[model samples]
Target: MQKQKTGIRHMFTGTLPQVVASLTGTISAVNDGMHYGWSAPIIPILQSDDTPIRISKTDESWLETMYLIGGIAGLPVTIYLVDKIGRKNSTIVSSCTSLLSWILIALAPNVACLYVARFLSGLAGDMAFVATPMYVAEIADQKIRGLLSSLIYLMMLFGILLIYLIAPFTPFYVPSIVGSLLLITQLASFSFMPKSPYYLLSKNKVDSARKALDRLRTTKNNEAELEDISRAIERQKKEKGRPQDLLLVKSNRKALIVMTVLNAAQHFCGISVMLMNMHSILTEAGSVYLKSTTTAIIFSVCMLTAATFSSFFVDKYGRKFLLITSSSLTGICLLVLAIYFNLKTVGYDVRSVSWIPIACVMAYAAVFKIGLGMVPIVISAELFSNRVKAMGMTIADAMYLIFGLLSIELYKGLSESYGYHVPFYLFSALSLVTTVFTIVIVPETKGKTLEEIQMLLKGEKPVCSNDDDATDNLTQA
Candidate 1:
């Protein structure tokens, strides 16, 4: 009993530093969430009688597209920054940009100012997504890496929920003020966290890398782990990090394909469209029992809750299982929603089933977050070797933004031309396609070390079960 108790206590102590570092770094995601979710509540107000700046439907769509355009623009900058400045500094830069964006939003004089502010926010969000995952993945213990990595999406969901809760009732500028304050808080707190050991080692600062690793791990003796990291870094450095390597190298090619498909599946499911236009969709549904704002709040809350629960299961259940299940269930929900919207569009008296949209959307929030919404972020961080990680992630992120931009536009164009059912049906079909893709293409990565994942990506069996073997494999590879 005493031995068992000691083991449990040691396990808890070992994970504490990792947890703290992850929380501090990922807190920036809350601000990203706020910026992403900001559109949902504010767009309706922009079209209302008490609007500060007048906006037509075209202008509103531009607001969303501009953010995505900015995200695409930021990808090249992020690829450069994450490698040149290191992950921690990159995140700090992201925080500063996010703060500036909120300030601009808070003090905007015209629609152009609003567009520019959103563009900056998108840039910051892209930076955070690229840098924070690498930082967290490099610092975390493999045993809990999935959970720690999932914190990125979990924090994002919290931010979304936060904005959803406040934006409807508060004044136009209140959410921006709150978002700015949170970014400041992240800057202050995360500034004290150590740089990623991988980044430090890549720069040939062995002593600094050791110190950073020490700060992230509870055990005083991390020499073995340090050596393992050094070996891996050395192996990766032997390969040229050219952009062509992302496709020329077999493993890199595989990782890119997997990520491209995953990103496509993630965005084509209409999550961005659903989130950005939730209030409008609900209002159009004509729900007699609840207001659109209230339903939006509930939608965000359900997403957050589902994401929170998913973090606990990611490592245990494995990434492939959760993704397949989430994708399958999400398609079903979307299909149901498509049917309901189609029925309403066909001049049917859907008044008797008015509550279906709410139920479908709420259920979609839960099922989607359980896997499809969160796992890709985690997997993207794990897939690439250090050689092409930055470039690979940037390309994947660009794909994510592009797909998002296209999906949102598809929603707007299809809905305006045909009806809401058209877009929903398209989203539902894409989601089903995603399910098949995950079942065949996406590899299971739960509980694997960075080295093991690379080996798996290379089509080699992972024989290393411990740090010593991982070091041997790195040296031999």
Candidate 2:
């Protein structure tokens, strides 16, 4: 019996099952990334005679705005679906929505169809975005939680890279069709995946949660770990996280506010538009001589490379160090970009150093990916309890789209009205703010369990398992 118990414990720590679950849960995110990146390459096609649609400049801006607005509009639907149906089912629903959107895009005859297609895709993305981080947090082991959660960003960046790479080589409709089939394949595989143990526990299905955990864990020998999960759920159930919980409770308010600020940081940094506009930005940078498609591929490659390092090293150096350092450097890069563009607009023969803008943007993408890109999402997953996790994510994502909408409009307007540097200055200031907020307010969560994180957010102290200085933080608290 002892040997059998040891065998079970040994099997529990295996990483393969956890990795598979992580990828399965992220199918919607992959599709979302593909859709967002699709816009930049597809825009010029809509203007060309290859398609019947003839979109003006103003219409193009609306096309950009439409996806964000659709995301905001889909929040309530996402919240209701995710909360009512459980994370796994909501994820499946999101994948199907994406599949449909791509089908529409593949067959779109006019601008109106394209508009509706973009909105549907955005709705699907919102659903996936809200569900993925929480699902990852619930299913991943404490040992690899941060890393696995950060993998979501990697998957997203890969999707963008995939589409951008394919677009230049293949016919335009091929990527869309390929994307549709990819969703189909992913959805088919995801159907066999297990549900979140936390979500099962929330429904009082203790035995089922155990089975789900066993399916995911594969290597832990001790019943003690499972028992600890039970105890953690019991503690979290005390605060079921009603919407009023956010307003009435101090701890809840802190979690909500902190998450909102970080999310706003993610948006206001201007990476979203930067990724989408990579092609256009390079073309217009005047001094950067790379072909437009090459620029997009390069940007995606840099981000993907940074994301790999981030996912591997996040737990080693801790989230706080990466966030602070990356954001500060990102700010400096953006400031330089602003100056370069300003000088270029004034005809200062900035071509003497034609590489400045490309170098700045590439550096900015790398630094941002290491910390700001993934840490905010990881933090969001760690902060909320199961009952309120959906609500919390919905609120944070709403803030994301709001600022995203503003940045999209502002980047276009300011670049046209003043200079391209104007928007970078705005982004630089926001990056500075993000860096300071992270340093001042964000708590470290190196190896704490979801429950311990809850206690930390609830003003109780946590002892970190990874860092020797963790006890000092508790005492400081």
Candidate 3:
């Protein structure tokens, strides 16, 4: 019985990689819609006198602020509901809300309606960030947990790439319409998507969790898996605690600190800001629209490489090494770009300039996707036990989305006022700081169980009854 239980747990390691993959379909549609809409037809739509909607500088500022405000407002509610409703159900609701937002944005008659649409989108965005990774981590076995968590970022990169592809050719309404349609599809199909068995067990729905476990696993040993899940649930019930309580505990405090710092650092890495304003950055570098579009494609291609390679290596290399290496690489690239900007400011004028900055930016994006871009999401979910998973993720995401708002606002204003290179330099300095933190704080969870990882984080030795051989695979490459 014990051996079979261990074997069933081992299956979770294999299940890790599939977690983020589940959301790819939804991610690709919404992400493309949001980014592509902003860069492509929306601009023309807003600028046209014939159009019913017109966006002034004031309108743009208000729209952005509304989105940020919505995120701040939604986090607490999402945290509460996820615990009450379960991961799968929460996602279905959020995705549906997002679908409605897209439709509203597409059919909006005035600036007021657009703000409401964006606000709704912001709510869904916050939900996705918190719920998706949490769902992935809860379902994943420890061995490849980091790799599984990375799927969100991988899917996100694909989302961004799809946007770049569709933006240049499609009409303004096309992306939003597509996003809405995809949302409908997701809502319809989610009936088939199983709820997180972990959540079920947490709620004492043991029979249901077992059924979900069976469906997700789809292998032999149903009785053994049920026993293992029951044991895990028993352990969790002993630790039954609130998110705030766990965060205040001495051992869990360290996990909180590490996760918080890492989450902040992920955004501070600057790739996100750059992505949000890719066209504007290219324009500053003297690239016209056509050239800017070409540069976006190149950047996306490089990012895709980083995403693919990271997915392959995350399980092999562990999280810490990849994070440190990627941070160092990103920092160096930012510093170089800073130098380029300094030269330009000092009066180096020539047309048909080298595309060095563009290339460097692409490389930086790729490196980020491999490490920092994906690590925070996984870490946040893993930091707490099931009792507090939703809340922990909620707090982490709240901080993340709040910082995200600041980052975007700062990027928009600072790029216009201080200079492009300055933001890169700032982000580079942040990356260095984050690298130091990663080395000193973050632990490797490659091939480790959630309980084992929690124990490891608490400075206790984790005893794995099954898959002792798997530990050998966790060493950094």
Candidate 4:
């Protein structure tokens, strides 16, 4: 008799449907950033009323301040909530914040209300950024965790697409309706989801953590791996409790420097600003063929597709190669756009020039997502030990948001005052600088355990690159 085939299937097959749903929730929740950043494209609707709220330079300035300031305000809450209540609860709260902000913004009586609503939304949006990654990383198995976390960025791009698609048809209320619907769905769906086992384990809920591990593992044969996971969890807790642990003490300030620089390098590439404000940037470069709404939608769709592909390659190609290649390619694309815009100054107004900027924008988005967008998160997880992963990720994200704010603010004014060429050229130069830094400093972490990564960061030569027998604390309970 033929024996029945029996084994645990891949986690992706069991989880892909849920992953897609979670992806939609995340994308919809964060869509507000694109909505506000491209407010210029929706300005005509905002102004059509008799008593109009002019989206002026002053308004944009206030909006920018609100975003950065609000994100700062939200961090303490996010940090406390993510560890305390677990990732699921924090995401629900964040989604509600976005929902409330959009409703108020859509029906605002004045410019002040708009600013306040956007500010609140920014605070909520930041919380999602913090919690979603943690949840994705926690729920996913070791094999596909990077790809799952990368989905956060990928879904954010889709949110951009939704906004761009809706902006043209019904300016102010449509995007708000879309955002609110997404949040309502998320609020409902996330209610049924289980709390993170990591948080439960931290609170001494080992039995619950074990159950969650079982459910998340999706197989009977996972019993052995499940026990290993529980032990690993215990080991991480003990390691974290030790005050003077080598990994906890910031082993090799050089690794800290490497991860930190790489993290900062991601935002400095101008990926967020370019995708968020694509419409205005294209218009600034003298594109007359595409309307702001159409351009914004196209740009958003391109970015989403590019980011989706990036998730597939992230693990296969390894982080370092992608970072170096993606950065250089992004820089080249920006330089071409810069050159085209600069040439326009001397009366070289060719009809084909319009599409050049569009093509360049797509090219830049493709490369940025493939390298800088996905790799930093992967590197952040791999660079430090399990003991430090939580705090290390927090620090990295904080810096990312801080510099991210600066990049957005700088792009807005720099593009408006200096010309379209200025922002793109500056980002291109920064990308080139980061490319060199990545090649020299960042090491490959593919298929290596966290403890082994720590050893590599310490500059200790290993018997084999993938061997981690020397630093097995992570593998113990």
Candidate 5:
């Protein structure tokens, strides 16, 4: 019993550095979450009679969407900075941008100021999403990479939950002030963390790469791992990583397809609509038992909880299983929501079933976080080789922003014209389609090293390297 206990302790002790590093790196995500969730509660306040800034309906829509537009504009800069300045530095740049955005929000004099603030927030978020995952994935041991990589989404959810809890009760500028403090904290702490070993190796800083790897692994014998990374980098360096290479190369093309579909499905499932419009959606449900603010809090809590739960099992159960299960169950929940709204729309008495929308949406939040909410980001970080990773992630992020923009716009247009049921039904059907796509097309990447994942994508059998053996021994030790 004592021996078994020691073994278990050893397992966790070995990965402690990785966990700390991942958490520190993902602080930016927490800030991004706050920025994303800020609009949810603040929008109603802006639109009401007692408003800080006067805004039209068009202004209201722009307030929510300007972030995404900024994200789209920021992608070119992100793609350039991610590879040019290094992942760690890129994240530092993002932190500074976030700080500025929040300050702008707190002191906004007009709707135009609000738009610029949201735009900078989106730009900062886009940069963080691209750089943070790459930093975490490159630093983590393969055994725990999924868990570490998933931290990005988990932190983002926490940020959302943080804003939800704070924003509804506080003054308009308070959340912005809080957000600025969080970014400041992130900037100060994350500045000390080492750069990714992979990035170091790519830049031919072999000694610095070794030092970073040793620091991350907390072990001295990393020569085998260093050689492995060097070999992979050399192979990748042979291929010229132009934007077109994402299509012309077989492995790159496969990676692009998987990430594209996954990102599209992620947004098409109506997550953005739900997050940004939770207060309004719950209010429209007409639940007399709980206020919309209270229900929205519950919604964000459930999402954060489900995401926390998923982090424990993502590696154990594998990506495909969780994704398929999450997508299928999410579709069912959305379908139920569609039915409830349709009943209310067609004059059927929904008084007895007023709780259905709350239940379905709460359930959707939980189920969606389990897989659809988090898996795409995890898998996106895993699929591409170092060669085209920056480009692939750029395209993937662009798709995520574009699809999110489309989903939000469609929801607004459809819900206004045809009723909420229309968009819910559409989201439900697309979710089911995403389920089919995952099973038939997406590759299971659990437990594979970055090289092995690339090999699998290229239709070759993955062969274990000396580094895998060495890393496995370190994990076991």
Candidate 6:
């Protein structure tokens, strides 16, 4: 018989605790996705005469833009507490806050309460985005890190897909009720898991960190490699990860530039605007696909399929490869979409191939998940030192929110002034720029350990290139 499969590499399949941590963490992402999909289907309902909170187009715009502002508001709070309180507790609090936001939405009697609730939910979304990845990255075995990192996006896609499927048919309040229940489940499931071993080790709780590592590892106690992990942490202790250091140090600066640029580029590509407002664009496309909710469902399904693929293949394929491919294809699809919209607006009578816009959106969603959506997120996690990871990630997360705001605002303004094709053309150009940047600069971190990643980010000699013996080189570096 072949040698029995047993070690960190099998944490996704063969280890119990690692599986538990990932599942518990991903459950919260459904809440994040619901926050996204909430506005898309409900916007029409709120704008119609049959609503409880009657308002103008301005209020409706606020409902969408407030989420981005809330994301911005949440960064300072997360930065203050993430390292101080531990990733597990911060995550638990994020779940509770998100639940409250939904509950507030359920109980809203006026527009003011709804606005407050949306902002709170935005805060919760950003917190989850910042904390969940850090916790998972720290606790996960290097072999399975790529897969687990992709889970946050996957779960968020499921949440978006969930709302699209159910909310359009149900009463206005039902979606909020169901989202609240999901958050409750995540809170309960997550309370049982341990904090990040890196966090614990940083806090000088060596025994606790070791126990956390043992639980995450498949081999009993992970007895042989535990000491090596402790040693790697010791090496990282020399790198004081203050916020200013992230900007000043050459290696840290390089990683920051790459991380910051990738995060901003993702939003400039116009995915979030498409995500929330795709149905409206579909309706305007004047296709048979717009007759029912099928178009929305298909687009969502395409995204889920792509995110699922990334959840499996990101590690095998590596970050830079996927980023370049995803960015390139996304640019082409956006260009096609721009031309399609322009032709239709000019009375070109292209109903013979009305399917082009829908097909482009679906293809764009699928290819985006494989790389642009997943790689920046995973690579950013690898760039920061543990000492200032909260700050580094908070800055990255903030840029995502700020750029998202610009994307949404720009789409609305440009469409109002010059037609929808303008934003599409602009995003396509940005995607091309992103593709070239990926080829020239983004470093690969497919199988590297966290310490090895930190070393690489610091512009020091890389400790380990592959996950197998990368840790053993930490001391040498």
Global lDDT of each model? 0.86, 0.80, 0.70, 0.67, 0.87, 0.82
lDDT of 2: 0.80
On residues 257-326, what C-alpha lDDT tens digit does candidate 6 reach at each position?
Answer: 9988898888888787887677778777865556446777888899899878877777777888899999
Model 4, 1-477: lDDT tens per residue? 222122112325456534644564465445655544535455556556533466665776576568657777877787677776777778878877787888887788878888888778778877777777766666664445567767777666666666666675664677787777777876777677665566666677878877766666545455554555466567566555332353445443555677678767777788768756776777767664776667666666666777777786665566788889988998899889888877875678756657787788877777787888777765664564555544555566677778877788888898779777788789889899999988887887654544445567767653344323322322222
lDDT for residue 198 in candidate 6, whole number 0-100: 82
Per-residue C-alpha lDDT of model 3 across residues 312-388, encoded as one tens digit per residue: 67766667888999888888888887777767877787345547667677778788877887677667777776666
Q: Which ranges in model 1 have alpha carbons more than 4 Å from their true place?
A: 1-13, 48-58, 283-288, 345-349, 416-419, 465-477
User: lDDT tens string, model 2, 1-477?
Assistant: 997676335323466787898887786677788887877777777777765477888878778777877888899998898778888888889899888888887788878888998898889888888887888888877667888888777888898998888876677679778888778888888888888888887788888887888788665553555676778878767885789887666666778888888877876787876876765676677655887788888888999999889887776678899999888988998899888878888888876787887898889889989888888887787887776778888988888888777778888898889878898899999999988898888878876778777777778876455453452243223
The C-alpha TM-scores of every prediction are: 0.91, 0.90, 0.86, 0.82, 0.93, 0.91
- In order of listing, the candidates' clash counts read 0, 10, 2, 0, 0, 0
Which of the two candidates, 3 or 4, achieves a greater lDDT against the reference?
3
Q: For residue 267, give model 5's deviation from the true position in Å.
A: 1.7
lDDT: which is higher, 4 or 6? 6
| Ranking 2 against 4 by lDDT, winner | 2
- Kindly list the per-residue Cα lDDT of model 1 for residues 1-477, writing each as its tens digit: 997675435334467888998998988899999988888788888999989898888999888778777898899899999999999899999999999999998899889999999999999999999999999999988767888999999999899889888888899999988988888888889999999999999999999999998888877788888988898899889879899999898888999999998888877887887877777787777764677677778888899999988887786678998998999899999899889889888888989888988898899999999999999999888999998999999899999988887888888999999998888888888888888988887888875679778888888987564343443343333
Per-residue accuracy of model 5 over 247-272 as CA lDDT, tens digit each:
99999999999999889898889998
Q: How far is 112's C-alpha from truth in model 2 (Å)?
A: 2.5
**Which window of ten consecutive residues has the lowest lDDT sum in model 3?**
468-477
Residue pairs with clashing backbones, model 6: none
Of 4 and 5, the candidate ahead on TM-score is 5
Q: Extract clashing residue pairs from model 5.
A: none
Against the true structure, candidate 3 reaches a TM-score of 0.86
- Model 1: how large is the Cα RMSD against the reference? 3.7
